[model samples]
Target: MNPEIIGQYLPLYGEAAILTVELGFLGVLFSAVVGLFCAAVLYLRVPILRQIVWIYIELSRNTPLLIQLFFIYYGLPKVGIRTTPAVCGVAGLTFLGGSYMAEAFRSGLEAVPKIQEESALSLGMTKAQAIRLVILPQAFSVSVPALVANVIFLLKETSVFSAVSLMDLMFTAKNLIGLYYDTTEALFLLVVFYLIILLPVGVLGTVLEKRVRYAGFGS
Candidate 1:
């Protein structure tokens, strides 16, 4: 490993890593919003809407993200639903993350005490009011760690965005190798980059998990 190669390749890899984080951060933010809404829908047991939410979750969760990305980038545009590569990457990742997160949030909602809802109803709250006030807060409190972990997973999964020309870290690393031809060094740096990005996330998730558990709404 020449320090000279590091000087050249590292900058490209760093840029790539930044792009990767940017893409994932946007996608995860969207997913968190979508997932929470969908989970709330299912939790509230809306007559027809919960079924639709279930279908959405199942379809996205069952399919591989690669195929999802392909369809978004290639398949949809054939029918005129065109978007830029970056937009497509973000959409695909958000859909993908949203599905998985719906399940997590749903599971957390299940852990809430049954009496909580009953008590809310007795207090003359509407279903929406009860859920918004009573259930969701508790559910979200229980699932913070899972949400954080999934965010980290989504962060790593953004590497797939390179295939769509999103120029994320993995894509940047490959480009770096093409320029520098130092496979060992470039690939090694790729691994190190992810470690740097994800380790702190993982540690933070664990700490948050401990806090949630100790706070008594936990598993």
Candidate 2:
């Protein structure tokens, strides 16, 4: 109801929204890379290293993401390793997102029939060639829906970074509330901002899921 107050705080909200998107975008990109790499390593059934990767994945998946963020932003300094909150937030989110992302990829990889590999081999493709050319593409395609879901979750999870003093949207909203002493407008606007950003994404996810499923890549 306070147009002047809303107008004054609009720039802060916009800047914070951009930063939050940037963090989520970077986190999603790196997490995808990490996820694919880990998925590949597991698919190959590498000795010893596979076990280590499993432990890392399990640890990441089982623990709360907040604890992981705390460890990166708070605990690492105790070991004489230091980093900015931005760096720590991105790293922690990437690590946590990668675990779940890898599982999505792993399911896709396994969904790819073993016979496809055999067929490629029969055509004189090397083992690596078979996997690279025949398996990875189909597997990744089949995983599109799951990947989209993971990305949505990852983006939402970025809100947690505000806990570490990251100037994300939630942090900005909290600051505005402090400044205006108006929790109703501040919090309501915060929800509206998130809805504005996420609603389209949710729609896109649905569209992509249906398209991929119909194309036989998301079965």
TM-score of each candidate? 0.91, 0.92
24, model 1: CA deviation in Å? Answer: 0.4
- Over the full model, what C-alpha lDDT does candidate 1 score relative to the true structure? 0.85
Residues 1-219 of candidate 1: C-alpha lDDT, one tens digit per residue? 777777777777787878787888889989988998898788778889999998999899889888999999999988989999989999999999998788789888987888888999999999778888888777877788779878988998888887888888788778777876888888888899999889988898888777666325242
lDDT of 2: 0.86
Maximum-TM-score candidate: 2
The total number of steric clashes, by the backbone 3 Å criterion, in model 1 comes to: 0
Residue-by-residue lDDT tens digits, candidate 2, 14-87:
88888888888889899999898889889989888889889989999999889999999889999999989889
Clashes by residue pair, model 2: none
